[model samples]
Target: MLRLPKYLWFVRMKVNKIVELKTLYSFEAPVFDAHGTAGTSQSAELKNKLDLNSYLAPFPGETYLVKVSGESMINEGIYDGDILVVNKRDRPVDGKVVIASLNGEMAVKTYRDIHGVIYLFSANDKFLPIEIKPFWEFEIQGVVKHVIHAV
Candidate 1:
């Protein structure tokens, strides 16, 4: 019942090479409190450089980014054009979002195992859960570690 995007693509990231921390750009920025008073502006200085590679992909060799395009997972805050940080080395836990291949097509969905039957669920209520059949070509490519979307 999931609606896949017309064109889905995966971009494999090569993060195996080690880069010197000093060579990376320093991106320190002020942090603001979202829950602060409406008129009050409170900012705090961050002491450390924001190394995206280290923060987002600790296990660089096994991590990759996949751009998603669909409304099926909107409720989970995964909208079209969102980038999913996936770790192939991570095990797919129950209720975790994962990148999966079904019948040679790629899709992202919450993984669940109920009574030993695997099911893929969409965050949006409009779509129904997909139950995996024994004969279907299915494989879990990686577990989604983080979802990056522009505000």
Candidate 2:
């Protein structure tokens, strides 16, 4: 996980929506300290401050974004138009959702370990679990930590 300080910021020139920011720039904002209902007005003791950057920031070069493109992971809440937060800096973990390039095709699947054998399982049962054979051009691109739905 990356942590960005409040003294500096970055700028993104978005044509439509917020894309992956690769550079840093100066940023300023008015941080609120009240924990109110999202759609309603409330008061607080001014003990908390909120910032979107705290949730997603300090994105390293290896921690990039990718847009999903299939229905294989629909059951897991990942859709075709969703943007995935992929962190290549971290090693792939068993039983975690990962972005992998299998035979030159990129796909998001659950990395499973069954008796020390690794396999990729699609959330949709229509697909079958793929064993990590010796002949495949398989590579773990990154581990998906966050997903942003387009809808």
Candidate 3:
């Protein structure tokens, strides 16, 4: 018996509502070296104000945030409850993670083009690659630029 991938059984894009960030916050914080051993942070000094808006989304009008709700992309460092920064105006390139609509369903997957054939791949092995057919209604919504998650 040939067993299919788990994603084939039920593949649905779990995403929260599209949100527009109207405010940009800037704060001053000390930068620490992760490679160095942790002992005391009293020696570290703050240099500049870190602006999240400039670092994450340079163009706020073309960017939006979406919360993930699945473990399919865990291998790619995208986990459930992580917030994804999507750029609507950015083009989806090969090997890049993108937000796409297939057959009227939205999903976040890695985009790939092999020999003219488009395939959406999941970072986790449990889910199989999804081949995009000509008959399916497909559209690339945006390209994911950054993923925000708590430590």
After the best TM-score superposition of candidate 3, give how far the Cα of residue 55 lies from its true spot, in angstroms.
0.8
**35-124 per-residue lDDT for model 2 (tens digits):** 756666676454544554435545556667777666777778887668877778778888888877665556688899888888888777
Whole-model lDDT, model 2: 0.65
What is the Cα-based lDDT of residue 125 in candidate 1? Answer: 77
Candidate 1 TM-score versus the reference: 0.75
Lowest summed lDDT window (length 10), candidate 2: 7-16
**Compared with the true structure, what per-residue lDDT tens digits does model 1 show for residues 1-151?**
3433334222212122222222244444444435556666665445555556667777777887888777888888988878888888887789999888776677888999999999888888777787888877888888888888989
Order of models, best lDDT first:
3, 1, 2
Clashing pairs in 2: 9-25, 10-25
Q: Is candidate 1 or candidate 3 better by lDDT?
A: 3
Instruction: Provide the lDDT at 81 for model 2.
Output: 69
Clashing pairs in 1: none
What residue runs in model 2 are displaced by over 4 Å at the alpha carbon?
1-21, 26-47
lDDT leader = 3
TM-score-wise, the better of 2 and 3 is 3
